[model samples]
Target: MGQRTVIPFGPQHPVLPEPVHLDLIIEDEKVIEAIPQLGFVHRGLEKLVQKKDYTAFVAVTERICGICSFGHSLGYSQTIEVLMSIEVPRRAEFLRVIWHELSRVHSHLLWLGLLADGFGYENLFMQCWRLRERVLDIFEATTGGRVILSACNVGGVNQDIFDEDLRGIVRVLDGMRGEFGELSKTFFRDRSVQNRLGGVGYLSKEEAQDLCIVGPFARASGVEEDIRSYGYGGYSALASFEPITSKRGDGYARCEVRAREVLQSMDIIAELVDKIPDTPLMTSVKGAPGADSIAVSRLEQPRGECFYYAKGNGTKYLERFRIRTPTSQNIAGMTKTLQGCDLADVPLNVLTIDPCISCTER
Candidate 1:
């Protein structure tokens, strides 16, 4: 047997943009085990539920992470809406779907770029981010912020995208399709990318289900679990929605799943814009939450499933607010995948699950 060596992967590493630290125990070049260290960037955003009123905490939740900000905002707002029994308008629902899907597109594009960079494909990385700029531009044009979109509220969305604006967004998405298709070919067919990712980080379908993995990570393993299929927000109106899945259960499969999701999100947005009704954007929110009321909201975030729980005490402030981020749930699976893999593949394997340390710890 080869002598064992212990290595510290990162609180900061070139491949990972977040502050996830891993202790890898290896025999020669093969990793025998991995232990994760979290909480380096915990912001205590969930703890602010007591300090801020339910209405004001939506913005607080939005600051969980820049990449998944909209998902956090939506989950928190949806929880508050349930607590208050706010009937979010159809137009508002549709608008929420539009922004949500656009955020998904934006997130997937960013991840693809990061994944490309992880594989040392700099040109591919640049191309992916260049396409992502269009999505961010749409965010700025519609909601006034590219990252922390303070557009969602308790009852509904704060901004109303006009027909002209919707058309413009559509134009931008359409323009990217060809270029994105070309970029996807590189990811799917390039020998270097395939060599780096294709069979690494294998998670079988049963293993994924047993770990209760969420989002594309699970879907890549052929587990057809997507919280969006439960029909929240504007997703209920889209009859054609289906969770994308791949049977390969490896790093390449994970990449393929997200790459396809970007296109799927575009289609969903088109469906939403075509059917979005012209009506009031925001509904008036009145009264404090009912005493002893508890609200829970779950949705398919860009990462996976995200959960928000809120408890009321008959006052302006919520008694408790809790979040369950997908990365937290997937960490065990990540650790399991790390066992018996080459040390060199560790970063790419970890990136396959797409950890958001801030969101996970917050």
Candidate 2:
């Protein structure tokens, strides 16, 4: 019989930048069971929506998670758009798709860097972040903020892109593509990274579907579910977009899924730059008509699918607002996937789930 032991993995850890806490029950060096604790960063952002007008509520939504700020704001705006029956211009929708994919690329790059750092591949970590900086530069150039763009508004977006700016973005992405390819090969083909991540903490397709997993986590497990396919944003007009999927449902598979998606995002952005139509960027959003109107909206964020529900009264302020982030829905599956994995594989396993505590707690 093996000796049993319990180890606390986080609340505060140098390797994990996020504040998620996990307790691992181990038999020797293998994990037997895993438990997760959340709510360490809760600030009740959902409840604050009732105090602000529908337009002002965008600020609160953007703060749901720093990494997913754009997606959060986009989701909130879409919900309000639905509630108010606003017809967003085609150009604005395409712009939304551009920024959305750009945000996705930046986010996946950040995760890849963190994953590399977890495995002690400091150079690889730096390389991934170096490429990610170009995406941030594009964000700052267009939206005025690197991390939290806060460019989404209720009727449409708050910013516009010019022809010169679009050309600059395309050039930067072209440069990033070459660098991304090299770094991806180094990470995926390296024996050390493969040994640490490949086939580690696997979840079967059935388990993933049964648990209602979202985003890359589910896509890696062979779930062909993507919110973009619903044509909520400008995705309906994306001529060459495809959802990235893998059947392995393991840590390495998740990494591959995100890496491939990053390339796809670049492709989407390039396509948009070539075809961006000239139109008005903003539509004025007036007050809500009644106090009981409600609408639900969902978006395919980089992490996963984020859902927002907004209810308004016959005033400037909303009556209630609710958000269900991808991380919150995937925590159960993440813990289940961690069981029976090697202790050394803990960081990769947790990261494969892309646990965003800020989104989960909020």
Per lDDT, the best of the predicted structures is 1
Q: Encode model 2's per-residue lDDT on 214-319: one tens digit a residue.
A: 9999999999888887777788777755678999988889999999999988888888888888989888776673668889998999988888887878788778
lDDT tens digits, residue span 1-362, model 1? 99999999998899989898899999999999999998799878887889988888888889998898888888888988998899988898888888888999989999999999988899999999999999999999888898999988888888888898898888889899999999999998899999999899999999998988888999999999998888887888887778999999999999999999999999888878888888888889999998999989898899999988889999999999998999998998999899999988999999999988888998
Task: Evaluate model 2: give its TM-score.
Answer: 0.97
lDDT of 2: 0.87
Residue 93 displacement (Å), model 2 = 1.1
List per-candidate RMSD values in Å: 0.8, 1.3
What TM-score would each prediction reach against the true structure? 0.99, 0.97
- After superposition of all CA atoms, the RMSD between model 1 and the true structure is 0.8
